[model samples]
Target: MSENEHSCYRCGDDLPGHARAWDYLLPDPVALLSDEEQDRLIGVRTEQVVTASGVGNFIRVILPVPLDTGHTATFGVWLCVTSRPEWQAVIGAARAGGETWSGYTFSGRLATAVAPWPEVFGARATAVAPGPGLVAQIRRSDERRLARVLTQVWPDSEILAARERGHVPGVMTGDRPRWRDWWRRGRRKTH
Candidate 1:
């Protein structure tokens, strides 16, 4: 790898040229549903949780929590425009050793298999890379499918925002991905 090459935070494989990274937000495994709704959603997959906050609201709670019905969960995605079929396998390897899902404090601690989720890098905050995290990588043509798959995983989640996004400096927190930040970065370069 050359100094110009940027390797994946998880896979350590050299990223192909022309790869475009993006971020999308999505609901946590548990959304803001009543007890009945949560049961209906995850069913038998989870156990009861105990918190020190005299019953933490985040327990089994939807991501970007507090139940933003009008908001869509976001995720980060990278479009690796490469024909190398092995890239998928390499990504899987990176994910295998990564921590994509969070809230084990509420989800219980048996330790389950790992899965990937979108994360941000560069300016603003960094997910996965702060340690090891997961994100999706796909061909440019399959972006829509990626969205569908993301939603399909959480049936009870109410989604209001879902799209490719760029992070901004001091503005792109895990809860927010301001699209205008991308343009702002370019504007700064010109000025």
Candidate 2:
């Protein structure tokens, strides 16, 4: 691939030959709810996961909730968007390997199991070079299915911890992506 070719944000691999003929399907945030027209979209289910197509890739999660909720639900979903090349690569490779779900720690290993949820739920997203970004909306049904699948795949404690943490590991870690820092450093040196 030529240096001019753009790569996936989550995975650093070149987007195959060119940015033509890419496929994408982002799930609607309310598709899993009983009433799709409800104005209020609170809770963990209202989230989006952005990913790239082909090879290893990472997901960019976006949350639509306040810091605190009145009550905790049985399971929670999360949205993440990373500007880091490493994370993108990690997720891309995992996807290609047919490993979907992932977690930050051993006790929070939800990433590996959840990885396949996107594909199974018809939310699998792909982006070619020079194309629009891809975002995936996971619903209650997907969560329930994923949770059920997790119980058999990973330890009970790990699965439970993932639920408590909203099925996202290191989610609250750094404030922003690493690329910002790199940009800052470069600007400072140039100045």
Candidate 3:
């Protein structure tokens, strides 16, 4: 395996496989918005473009669990840069401010499988390359939690519930065990 083909023991996802370590490159216009611009979105600084290379230079944000329940899947947020200049600039700013961002404890929210999702620790930046984008993933073990989180995030969506009857309303009705089976199987497999 190449240097970056580390397996995610938690999720079983083969990230940056040995053969494709350099394949997932990302490049485009990159900029770091000020605090005001960052906060203008749904969440405050939920995402950021880092113009530097260091620990904590990137961040993954996990949404907070709602107050009613405490079991939902967590979403992921990444603060990254798509260009070398962006990374360098952010790193420079950190150094100039006498701020050491390396080794910082960054964590994201988890889907609780229902209401309030749990918290998850983020991986550290062991390597940085100007391609393949800063690929972040939800741990494989967190799949079920993530499903629940997604469901909670959209209550009326019925992602986990049975699909609407395939037959036309008031037109035709018959046993659709196949469809039912599909949903059951899918939900089970996801969980």
Instruction: Give the C-alpha lDDT of model 3.
Output: 0.28
| Candidate 2, 1-191: lDDT as tens digits | 36656565456667643232111222222222235332343222212333322111223332111112222122233222223554555446435432233322101112222322332222222221111232332221233444343233433344334444531121211333242232223212211
For model 1, residues 1-191, the per-residue Cα lDDT tens digits are 66646566556777654232222221122222346745554422322121111111111211221122333333332221112233334334444645533211111111100123222111111112223442322111222423333334432132222222322222223343332343234112221
Q: Write the per-residue lDDT of candidate 3 for residues 77-174, one digit (tens) a residue.
A: 34332234544654454344322343222222211122122122121112222122332333223445444443344432231231222111110113
Report the lDDT of model 2 for residue 178: 44
Model 2 whole-model lDDT (C-alpha atoms): 0.29
Q: Which stretches of candidate 2 lie over 4 Å from their true place?
A: 1-48, 51-76, 98-191
The all-Cα superposition gives candidate 3 an RMSD in Å to the true structure of: 18.6
Residue 59 CA displacement from its true place in model 2, Å: 3.8
- Candidates ranked by TM-score: 3, 2, 1
TM-score of 2: 0.19
